[model samples]
Target: MLLKGKTVMVTGGSSGIGQAIAIGAAREGADVAFSYWGSDEGALKTKEAILETGQKALAISGDVALPESAISFVQETVEVLGKVDVFVSNAGICPFHSFLDMPAEIFERTMRVNLHGAYYMVQAAANQMVAQKTGGSIIAISSISALVGGEYQTHYTPTKAGLLSLMQSTAIALGKHNIRCNAILPGTIETEINRDDLADASKRSYMEARTPLGRLGKPEDLVGPAVFLASDMSQYVTGASLLVDGGMFVNLQ
Candidate 1:
């Protein structure tokens, strides 16, 4: 039990990679609390799975796009599950839109949810950790898009890239408090956000061929990496971006 007697809070944990991370933490003996935007059904399912592991679970419904909501969520987590030992800022949105067709409203909304929301969550978590005087870990779920540009992700990729910079800054600012911050850059994982894109045979084949592993990554593929960052195994690691992209980032061809 890498996280025995710990408490973990995850955002956007109702489904996909976030869901997997929440469940994985619970299995490692960490009580889990997660936030969901609007999916009661999905949130309930994730809560049930975490409870099945014999770890307490709290499912909070709120919009991370609002700073107040993010602050409130963290406060609620502390009130229920005690101090958060690990905070995963995984709530984000990636909408495909060609640069020429992108609307200003859409772009702003993306930044609000992906970058600003993460900022609030990280700030709140760090404050709580400092208050408790217990060092903690903060994991930001970024993406390969942050490394390389995407044709339809001009608006989306920047937010992901911003996360890396945010983590670095937080790592430096919070190190004295013993709080570590890192980013997890996942490859083209098969998730609800990218399901339609991956379903296209041509795009799917292109992605698989480009990836050295010859397959698109699954949500489960990220569980181990996330757990490593959250646990004491990575006590000395901070301000780093761990890529879990199945070698796609290195395949130049």
Candidate 2:
């Protein structure tokens, strides 16, 4: 019950790390609200899992890239689940494209979804947290690529990098209000988006060779860190990027 009586909003909680984090939050005794960009199938499944932990759940559908949508999500979540004590900005996209071959539209879309969307969500959530006069936590799901350069991921990397800065600055600005902001930078997590490709032997080998742990990460691997951040265990933590990459960055040669 690390988060007992807390209300948490998780964006893109349909699958992957987002889903795991949502479930983890529920298990920690927090009422949870999660947003999905696509169908409710995945979100509903996650909601079911969360309810099994005996927490109230809300699986909402909306596009995070739209500022209005982000604002509405916050308002709706607050109305349904009460005040948000933790906000997890997990909505992001990574459409791989070579720098030279990438289209302008691709870059714009990535920035819209990955960077701008999270910014707006934070803004909306911060307003609520401040008004409630209760200390809260804001967690951003970034990527290790933000710290290291990656091939064919220029757009994705830059946006993740922006998240780090956003978290840092927000933490500073909100510290007096007892609101903490932080980011988690993951490396090569196995999710639906890359599951098929990672299953291939050659691709698997490439990822294993780079990670010092000798394997790609599972989506659930991010849950523990997320729960710690959301709980009183990390009350003194803020404006930090916890790289849960199994030493992938360190092993890079």
Candidate 3:
């Protein structure tokens, strides 16, 4: 029970890595609150799973891309679960498109959701934590793409990179307030969003061959890192980027 009596707020917790983090936090004895953009069914399933752990859970629907929605999401979570001791900004979108083929609208949308949304959530959560005089943790779900350029992710990669910069700046700016901010960079994780991309034999083989682990990662692989960052174990860790990439990023080739 590393997080006993704490409250955690996870964005996009309806499924994938977000879902895993929310459930994992609940298992560690933290009350959980999460947001889903469009999947009511998935949200319900996440809530049910959290409740099964005998921890309180709240799931709301909202688009994090919008500032108002992001702010409201945090406010609602605090209203329901008390105060947020941990805020995981995990809602993001990745659309593969060559730079030449990327449309302006698509690029803007990607930035709005991945970068702008994270900014809004972090600000809201940090404000609450500062007001309460309780130090908190803010975790952003960045990507390995932030470090390595992707041919098909020109637009998406920038958003992830921007998140890294944002976390760094936030860490420095909020350290005095006792709020820790960090980014988690996951490699090729198996999730609904990237399932089709990883299903191709060639793509799967390419990823596996590049990763020293010889396998793609699962959402569950990130649960431990998320819990660690959210708990007291990472009190001294801030302004850092933790890579959960299964050694993929180390392959120089």
Instruction: Name the best candidate (by TM-score).
Output: 1
Reference-based lDDT, residue 124, model 3: 91
Candidates arranged by TM-score, highest first: 1, 3, 2
List TM-score per model, in order.
0.99, 0.97, 0.98
Q: Report the lDDT of model 2 for residue 174.
A: 96
- Residue 195 lDDT (model 1): 90
Model 2, span 119-189: residue lDDT tens: 99999999899999998999999999889897878988999999999999999999999999999999999
Predicted structure 3, TM vs. truth: 0.98
The models' CA-based lDDT, in order, is 0.93, 0.92, 0.92
Quote model 1's TM-score.
0.99
lDDT of 3 by residue, 1-253 (tens): 9999999999999999999999999999999999999999999999999999999999999888989987788788888888889999999988777898789999999999999988998999999999889899999999998998988889899899999999999999999999999999999999987888987999899999999998999999999999999999999999999999999998888
Which digits, one per residue and each the tens of the lDDT, describe model 1 over residues 1-253?
Answer: 9999999999999999999999999999999999998889999999999999999999999999998987899899989987889999999888888899799998999999999999999999899999999899999999988899988888889999999999999999999999999999999999999998888999899989999999999988989999999999999999999999999999997
Residue runs of model 1 more than 4 Å from their true location after superposition: none
Measured over all alpha carbons after superposition, the RMSD of each candidate to the real structure, in angstroms, is: 0.7, 1.1, 0.9
Instruction: Please provide the root mean square deviation of candidate 3 (C-alpha atoms, Å).
Output: 0.9
By summed lDDT, the worst window of 10 consecutive residues in model 3 runs over 93-102
Residue 3, model 2: lDDT of 90
